[model samples]
Target: MSPLNALNWRYAVKQFANTTLHPQQLEPLLEAIRLSPGAFGLQPYRLLLISNPELRSNLLLHSMGQNKVTKASHLLVFAAVQQIDEAFVADHIECMTQQRGGTAEEYQGLEAHLNGYFRNMSDQEKVRWADQQVFLALGNCLTSAALLGIDSCPMTGFNPEGYDQVLGLAEQGLRSVATCALGERHAEDAAADLPKVRLPAQVLTRVLV
Candidate 1:
């Protein structure tokens, strides 16, 4: 399907069917999220593709009674880094060197710039910035899932501290910012029949120039 058609057909699936995605369908969606853009390409987050039933059940407890947390075939947890420091900048610089076939010394200038930019932000600002990056990946997941004819429900109604504790995110210096449930929609899902409510294009967009 074309992107617009896929989007038109997609909705936040309220009920998932008892169907699992074939690896062929799931892989490409994962690739789209992996390739999602971020500030400075630091990708200050980790995407947790969870299929473990026990873990999902535990997460449901923290999800503010959202059954989709466990009802879906898979759960995607977007965990943002708790902090961005000199070490984080250094790691990105080394990755750039290894991937681009250059010496770390050659990227010292870039590294310094990144470090300086992040240093200006307060601790709270740093986490807020990371959370924004995670949302970019979440948007990619939703669009890719739709294009692949998979059902998805993106949510942020859960308790973050509970999720962080259950997922051991704090130990990893991460915190759950959002989640997307993925699967096939149930045939009886009334939401599928509802017309999408959106602002008209003219009202939602503009040309400044």
Candidate 2:
């Protein structure tokens, strides 16, 4: 199906089927996030894959009893780095350089430039920067799932402090920015039959020419 058609078919899945997604179906979703576009290619986010039943059940509490958290086959928590220091930027540059067949000196110089740029930003600015990266990843994941005919829900209705504590993310210097639940749609979900709701093109579009 075309991208437009895939998007039209997608919805914020409120219920999920009991069947788990196969590895073949799951890998592409992951790959989409791994290759997601980010500002300056910093990719400052981490995707946590939770498939354990007990853990998912525990997370339901932190997520304010969102049934999707426990019902979905996989819960993806998108997190951003709490801090970006010189070392982190340097390491990322080095990895990219190696992948692109660049020399050490070339990568080091690039890293230096990145470090200088990030160091000049305020703490709030850094947080905003990282948050934007997480959103990019989330968008990519959602689109990918839609194209694959998988049911998903993009969620931001969780307790961040409780989540961080339960996930032990502070120890890794990461904080939750958003989450998504992926699985098959429950057979009896009434929302599945609802028509798509959207604004008309005239209201949402603009012609500058």
Q: Pick the candidate with the highest lDDT.
A: 1
C-alpha lDDT of residue 74 in model 2? 93
lDDT of 2 by residue, 44-129 (tens): 87889999988888788889789999899899999888878887887787788779886778777778789899989999999998
Per-residue lDDT tens digits for candidate 1, residues 1-209, read 89999999999999999888788888999899989998988899998989899999999999999999899999989999877999988988888888898898899899989989998999989988998999998998899889888999999999999999999999998999999999999999999999999999999999799
lDDT for model 1: 0.92
> Best by TM-score, which number?
1
Superposed model 1: Cα runs more than 4 Å off: none
TM-score for each candidate, following the candidate numbering? 0.97, 0.95
> Which 10 successive residues of model 1 have the least lDDT summed?
18-27
How many residue pairs clash per model? 0, 0
Q: For each candidate in the order shown, give its overall lDDT on alpha carbons.
A: 0.92, 0.88
